[model samples]
Target chain A: MPEQPDQSEQPDQSEQPDQSEQPDQSEQPNAAVEPGPGHRFAPDTEWRRVSPKYLVVEVIGSIITTAIIVAALLVAFSLWGLWWTPWAAGAVALIAVVAIAFEPRRVRSIGYRLREDDLLFRRGIMFQRQVAVPYGRMQLVDITRGPVARALGLADLKFVTAAAATAVTVPGIPEAEADRLRDELVALAESRRAGL
Target chain B: MSGAAPAKPAVDLADGEWHRLHPASPLLRGGLVFIAIAGFVIANLRERVVEFFLVIFAPGQLDDGFGEWSDENDWGRDPIGGIVANNLVGWALLAVLLVVVLVIVGFWLSWRMHTFRVTPEAVEVRSGILFRSHRSARLDRIQGINITRPVFARLFGAAKLEVQVAGQSGNMQLSYLGSSLTDGLRRDILRLASGARATTQSPAPAVALPSVAAGETLAEPLPGLAQPAGPAAAPGTGPATIGSRAGAIVGQRVDEFLAPELDPELAPPESVVHIPVGRIVGSTLLGGAALWMLALAGIVIVGVVSRQLWMLFTFVPAAIGIVSYFWSRITKSLRYSIAGTPDGVRVGYGLLSTANHTLPPGRIHAVEATQWVFWRPFGWWSVRINVAGQSVTSGAEAAQRTLVLPVGTAGDVQRVIALLLPEAAEGGPVAAQIGSGLTGRAGLDGDRFSITPKRGAWLHPFSWRRIGWAASDGIALLRRGSLVRRLVLVPLARMQSVALSAGPLRRGLGLAELRLHTVTGPVVPTLPIIEREAGDALFTHLAGEAVERANDDRSQHWGREAADA
Candidate 1:
């Protein structure tokens, strides 16, 4: 119930357009054009969200996973006379339903912004994380697409550094945008390659 | 050796040429197992082996001599005594000699095939007879060099040299090099990796070869046959006094065993910090053994109360395991010493079999000084470091190697830190800040460290006072945890990225956790539960500083003269 107020307050804050950086729009090529739902923490910097079709991708992926689990459980029941299979399958379906319901909001929450010296990626709603990976420190930048994402023309951009803990992945990017980002990142990384 | 005269330039062993490893390399690298198996087979089947040879050479004599003995001793069931009974002892000895000769020839051939080459750009090693795999570690990417002498290898005066480069499977290992050459070879490689020109190389120190006299004597004649003797041999000892020389080598090895682990010629004559044997034992016990002992005691008490006498039977193995753990810890820390060498910081440990690792300047990614609650009473601190290629190993081996200072006092910690970060140690403020961070309690002072606010106590009730972060002179210090006080220092140049996160609880409290990402190692550089405003400022500051510092960093080519010079 306490989270309700916190969730409600986020929409109002996102609606307010960043007033200070109106004239500097020319500098930020990847800046959000419309005043879409903004990041509550970093309101001034424009954050680019994933494509809306990512929601459909998430739903389809979740449904497929649930179906596989249900099929496995039914097979177990038929073969081994497992009485608990129906209960376990029902629980899996319920969890998948809840996850699918939250798919759109989760997709909306994921955003990445390019700053002067680093790329800042932000994700999650209640437990928010913002990471700034300096362009110089980037060891590699890779783009990967799953079958579902490839059909939907979406790809994931991943940034690798010397530190394994800096696991920064920007998922659900349009395939073309992902390619552009990868090229830019690779060029920037080459220009500013900092050896560990 | 006077300062005024031009010092004799040490011979550079890394001159570009393909060099075979020590003659004993084959035996040290898994050939010993073959020898042992051969010995076991020969010892058990001495009779069968001799009889088979007798059948070929003296079949008529074998039939006449063994016919009477076979009936008397039931030789079919007990063929073990056939050599003596049939009087074929001389033939048995000949067969053993032949097997030994064949094994020696095979080993020599294998040794000839495994060759390594050192170039200005890279150290290349080509090994494996049939598979023929080649491994190369580039000079510029060299992280550190480790020289390890296992007890058996030490007897032969051989050591393993591992060239640590910056990735998984990047280590190039030279299994059995003469121990005398390992020290000089490591220094030359580090100098080359530092981008120092061969012409500008400083006069090498006169390395005393007394410790490896045994190896030198053994390796001397072999190198003469292989190639012209490289400067591996000491001056002026000939084969004329072979009897006296063998006796002298034994005396030297014994002296070497009892001597202090540090070689004065390689590192400083004295260690920067000397940890007493008593303290090492105490620290080991206080570290984890005490907890295990308590658990055991608890179990015993429960068993006694319940009258379950059988429980005592299960306790024996657990008790033995704990005791052995204690023994290993003691042995590992027996002669632990760290000192500054011209190459970098040299850390040596172990009692019988010894390991010496030289971490060159700027190789340390991050450092952490931590104090256990039990150790707090004695003011004991353990220092661990993150080196680039070191994380390839896991568990106890990784833990043991990464610990630069296993246990030391606050003063010792300061000295070790100064050695690790000479750039940060210049003006002494960093050392003073570190000293305070090691022992200081929480305070709301604007100067020194920006500590967690009083309101942040809700999140870290016990450690809120100790939780703080400070950045100065291209280094960031994060102090956290009261129970196990930890101080993490990350050179801004080495930071991979900066991350800020606030979970639901922390968000409500208006605080965030700031992490400075470095290479994966024991040190986790996180400044947890600081003010959200402070976190935001630090994130931006660190992100900018990391890039600028990285651009300005000349630590990679540390031995190379500055551009301005």
Candidate 2:
């Protein structure tokens, strides 16, 4: 199967996505025009970032879970009273701290844009992903609030479509925004779905 | 839209009455299963029962190797005969009676608990004795309706109806109904779903209770006639009415013997491609079954040489299991035929129990036609379509449902292509291009398709020349496979999303794999190890085309009208 590339042609690398610190300006205009008429983002379209309090909620939640694991390990090791138990717990606590500390930046990376006919959500730092859910295809638009999220007055807006792969979740939005977006999405979906 | 109205009661159905299953349904379903088990048990007990008979009735015959070797010296043992003639025979008879009585009770209870009702807009089934579960399927969302009759069920004039619906969940099954009413019910359901009246002033077709027994509804139209008759006065002959009912029941029996062919709307398709019986048998013998047989033979030889008779027992059941598999596949696809209808495609096949599947518009997500290395010489290929709900169900049951064509000629492949996406075959330039790339000879040198770079061939050594992709105005085609050549066609409008990725090896080879995500189905289209530059251009092009196609179809009310009609 190992066949060399034909020597007559040069291997084309022009199509490679520019991974420079700044994306190519020429590509942005083309990407923006590709979605067609009604292609323009809504005049009031704003990329709403998640609540900062969500970071506190995530960190506290992770620390609490880690504490339980540490406590369980300590209880199990009490009989032997190993000298390294405290050190190991300390190491785990440090790891948990480093992991939880990334929550704020990760939360900042998540944003959702409400367009005229669809909703766009982009998330992740290292592995970026953006999904657009057309209003007519929205089977369900739900808001879910876990205990920690509820305490922090934050909720996740989950959009479900016919193909499960197209489902997107805009996490850690303020409770008020969640209600407003959900109502608007439902109304839009109803009108569009009626035509279908 | 949120929650102004209170929750509606679940089971109301357009003023229709709940109908119990036919009287023979219980005997046909639960009782038959018990009977099969009881038959196996009785067959195993036959030798012992025969010995007991000989020892009791004829002591002379007991010397003809009838007894154990230890018992030879006492061949004339009279004490055992007394035991056999007394309590043993009575107890055995009582046990058999109890078992039969239990089976009858089980059947009766299950049948008593289950009932169904058909409304103009939906079909509702309420089953389960203790749990009391109810399921309702909306008529408009119903994707396909399958009516199957097993040989045993046919003898008693019963059939099973499965209603396939949209989405990834929810399928309703009404099993063991009298064969006489199933066709009428099937046609009525399809008509109602297509926005036609099912229960208008006509009671003769769907609700006909044997024309002779319940002649009151005789004024209604006959089913499968495509017209409702005007009410007319009947001759006032009492005996004649009874005679017709008896005749109708007998006619139903004959109809069961020849099922799919008898019902016109759901008839054996007029234009169809039938797989030859010899090809099916030959393919099975030459395919995986050959390897399985060799393995079985090795086990048998090992058992014989080791004098471990018990070892043979293990492999014997495994061998039989393999044999039954081939038997089932052959039976399920013996006379496979697929035909196109105005609304959708219809498939029918089977040896013992025949299944007829009618996939309505907008049901199929993707289509795959494949040719295995062994069957390539004979010009045989199998076609599979992915309907939304059928994939995650039981694998064995899915086999009967998703197979549009188990095996057929080149003509069948084109027919299947037309059936799967009729819109593509209507001389749409891009669609024709994609179609040719799909059904034409598998090669990288096609004019319409872009072949993978030769360097990328390292990733797919066996099938390098076959790896390529072609895009039409509304759809994209991805070709792959070496031994089992496959072409996957995904409508751009139907795609959920797309992805491009390269692993460690792919990066070194300057290649990436492109995945076009549709719903979960039998065929997942992919182009692997293509030039990275080509992958990026294709990705952007497909993404733009998908958006445009979705909007065009939606605005023109094309795809949506068919699904929501």
Candidate 3:
């Protein structure tokens, strides 16, 4: 778990992007393209992956939801005197186990990068995406934590921009980290959008 | 709040005085409900009038329906006409007087409850009898000001001022002000907004005063109509100077404003573009609103000829309602004209209730130019842009507001395109090529872009070859349509997100549709059913282009001062 960087030093970082791997001449300052998983904007840039506790939350939620559905199905099967009822429960348990095993890897694929003037977040495995939101265009930044996430000390940071399609959500970061990132992004957005 | 207080001009509105709406406000706002009620009453009266005719002309028919009952009841036997003939007309007149009194009392009460106040920062309006509610819009966020005069309000020398702001769910409407006052207020606000920006840059002189030519034949000023004209209105209450020296000078030099005085005549207009009546009607008919009108007309005609007079009670009102609905829609855009000013794009249109829209630069999120299939022969097209914060007011009004041009020649399209997207049009392509690219018509310049495969024609039986897309250095253009040709131009900087989707059938044909998400407006921002490889390339290419140009300074600020800011 990487700590969210303090953005008070942004002015320094903005002036020193040239010192970080020649500033990638092929790429635009606003474009954040990732060919595959495990990508960052600069060589020194750190990619913040969601907390592993997110998987625990996911597994618990999955088990509880699956148990409720299976219990209901079991009641119906037994009340109707269906002998293969136990087999149905066993199948559901199997599916839940498989889902729990895959949860961590899926969570690992989601990562976000904070750049000098924009933020980039990439998610999905089969149909991968990388979206960049400029600080000047950001309208709102909201942080929300569900019961499961709250218990696990995690929150979701959502970046809202003028264009609905470009809004990005980075989920399962530690709560404190989420707050710090939100504050920094808000400040940056305010300064960048001053003239507007 | 008393009506006795003299009306204050909008110029002195900065003192934060809470002023009620022009006394005639209720007559315009609540008058609609009253008119509807009156319509019902007249409908009832019309039915009685028809019955009276039947009683007089066809006594035998009347006897079959109500004569037996009339004979059984003495009071009913006389009817109202017989009573009047018997010299009981005074009683009838008293009853009518009582009803009129009740209506007047209603209008008065509604009028008394509504009030509005204007401050330098925001405009606040409050109205509610039981459940009081207040709404206000900050001056900084306001996108435009529209002055509207409905047919009835016009007769009373009143107009409605609608303050449109970015992101607010509803427009802040102040109704029933004098027409000239509303115009003066619009100029005042725009000037103020522009003046505020000038503090940070060089001051540009205000353009020539809005020409009265457009409003002359249309009853420019019903001056005498405003019985209580404000005290300060005699000399025009709006700020007359380009830059007032009333404010305290801070760090910047006062002399800097005096330098670089460009020719005001050479400067582009603050606002001007009008949609002619022919185009307004043409575009509406072409968009299928005409079909609805035709179907309604047929029903009304058939019902009347078949002696189903009851249909007048039913379909005639409905027909009139529909007709008025479309009539209002067409007329609302009748004289559509947009002017480019430092504050924003000031749009004015409408025959009876003209609307003036001030679209500040940077407020517009996306721009798209489209031509329907029917419009192809005439080489006419309509342009619409998406701005932040407008609540989608049904599809029709949304289409209306976003219209940069209701109907325009190809040359007009190019001019508007250039005005809206100077960066994209700068030395990129000729106006004709842009027009052809927009219409998806392959004459000489359309082939400059990539066209869909001949197999893609299977998807668009009506327009296969015409479906194509081209990417310029700063913008991406997608043209699609057969009967209704549409050209969507996405400024790379404004592209929010890009997506590609393919149904099973499209996948089978190795084709997919690419969609670029833009702000809410009339344009759909899509490249429908192109080759799968092309879709992928477009998606990736646009994403990159959008990012590259994300910081492109396209604000409408002018001069070296504008550059510094």
Higher-TM-score candidate among 2 and 3? 2
lDDT of 2: 0.66
lDDT of 2 by residue, B174-195 (tens): 8877665666566556655654
Q: lDDT by residue for model 1 over A66-177, one digit each (tens)?
A: 9999999989999998999989999999999988888888889999987655788989877889998987789999888999999999999999999998999998999998
lDDT of 3 by residue, B106-201 (tens): 778766777777654577888877778899887656666666666676655566877877664667777877553455556545544442433432
- Candidate 3 docks with a DockQ of 0.14
DockQ of each: 0.33, 0.09, 0.14
True contacts kept of 2: 0.14
User: Which docking band does candidate 2 fall into?
Assistant: incorrect
Model 1 lDDT on a 0 to 1 scale: 0.78
Per-model TM against the reference:
0.80, 0.70, 0.66
Worst 10 residues of 1 chain B by lDDT: B1-10
Best-to-worst order by lDDT is: 1, 2, 3
lDDT of 1 by residue, B1-565 (tens): 1331233222235766788888888889878798789789778878666766776687676655354555545666656456557767678779978987987887887788888877777999988766888888888788888888888888877789999889966788998887667776887788667665433433422232232332344434443433323223433456434534565565545544554666665678788888999999999999957899889989999989999979977998999999989988888888888998867898999998888888988888899999999999999999999988766456676677889998999999999998998855645678768976888866534336776778888988899888888888889999989999999999999899989999998998899999989988889999988899989888878887887788667678776654225
Which scores better on DockQ, 1 or 3? Answer: 1
The per-residue C-alpha lDDT of model 2 at residue B70 equals 43
Candidate 1 vs candidate 2: the lDDT winner is 1
True contacts kept of 3: 0.19
